[model samples]
Target: MGGFKATLINEIEKLYKKKKIIVAAALALIFIIVGQLATIALRNGFGVRTVGSMEFPILVLSVVANTIIPLFAALITIDSFSGEFSQNTMKISLTRPVTRFKFFTAKLTAIILFVFLNLMFVMVFSVLAGLIFNSNTLTAYGIIRIFISYIVTIFPMIILVMMIIFFSNLINSGIGVFFLSIIVFLGFKVLGILFSDYSGIFFTSMLDWYNLWIMSVFPFIKILREFLLLCSYGIILFTGGFYLFDKKNF
Candidate 1:
């Protein structure tokens, strides 16, 4: 148990040491800045007319957050496995005291933790900016709703990240995983819209879980149901990604 914990900790340290993670963190900060700026601009321009001034800002920020954060998450994970093989680190890491399953799980766990933390940070910062710009406090219930929606939205996003991590091992080229992830993300999204009738299967479009919040408009049982399903979808994709990853060989 002690050894396993140590190994996990080391894996986490390794993840943070990467330049890609640094770049991703920097990009998330940009998201924060842009979200804050956009909110302020929208409120000033709209100023409570047909829509609440805060409405456009929040909506635009949410759109940006939902669309962009997943790409960050995927880029973070893209190199996790593939990087090991490409850099020839696999020979050392896999030959260590830890089992391959444990190594993979630790990496996956770290990736998920990073994605969740980053996602929460961006959402919280955006809301804080919204508060600053609009002077409209998101009530406790509103905060809770937003928090739930953010978490649900990020689940599918992380699945996309995990899938990219799984692919990283196959490609095993520097920056290849990141580029491939972006391409797949954009392509799948297009496919999802072009084939809207079967959009549910594609994890990328599942970010629309936010629509449920608007659908219920007041947090009812139906919204709760949809939230559960959305969360389940994330779990399924994440676990399936791992299952495939475990079978992958260098």
Candidate 2:
């Protein structure tokens, strides 16, 4: 346990040094500023409060979860897996007193931490932006809903990371893994659009799983069903990715 903690710390430090987190943070800030500005423009020019305080954050979350968060998840996963192998850095890490499983979990745990922090950062900034710009009194209940909504998003994001990690392990090149991830992700989006009825079955389609939680009446059955689906995907991808990472020559 102690060794795993140390390795996790090392993985996090490497991610911190890589600066992708900085880029993701900056992009999120930019998106919030732009979103608020657009909202202000609409209200001033066309006389509209289309996005209220709670609505603003929710809107930001949709974009962040669907686009920004997943994009960086792929990048970070590729960098941590494929980047390490291509750069011959994984060998150095493996030289330490650590088992392959420990190394894999530590690295993945670090990525999960990155996603969680990034999500929270977006939630905080978007909430503040909404409060500052939109004059909507989010009741305590509404605030609770927003918090729950943001927190629930982390589950799907983790599953997405696991999927990408699986691909990264299969493909040796960082660039190959990145392009393949994008192609596969975009393909999934297109398929979802073309096959609306079957879209619900895809893991990518569950990015907005938070909506089930934030509903007026809790859809317990639907939430549980989707939660179980996500859990299954997470478990399978994580096990498969771990197996590949463990057996790799690196």
Find the candidate with the highest lDDT and give its number: 2
User: Model 1 residue 143 lDDT?
Assistant: 65
Give a tens-digit lDDT track for model 1, residues 1-250. 6656777898889877877666766776676677566555665787623222234334643665555567666666756666566677776777678766677778777888777776676666666666766555546656666666667665666566666765675565748777777788888889998999877666666667665664445657755665566667656655666676667664
What TM-score does candidate 2 get on C-alpha atoms?
0.97
The per-candidate count of clashes, in order, stands at 0, 0
Global Cα RMSD, each model:
3.6, 1.1
Give the alpha-carbon lDDT of every model: 0.66, 0.89
Cα error, candidate 1, residue 51 (Å): 7.8
True-structure Cα RMSD, model 1: 3.6
For all predicted structures, in order, the TM-scores are: 0.78, 0.97
Give me the displacement of residue 184 in model 2, in angstroms: 1.3
Q: Candidate 2 residues 1-250, lDDT tens each?
A: 8889899999999899977889999999999999999999998999985778888888999999999989998898899999889999999999989888998999889999999999999999998998888656677776787899899999988988998899989989888888888888888888989999988778888888888898889899988898899889988999999999988996
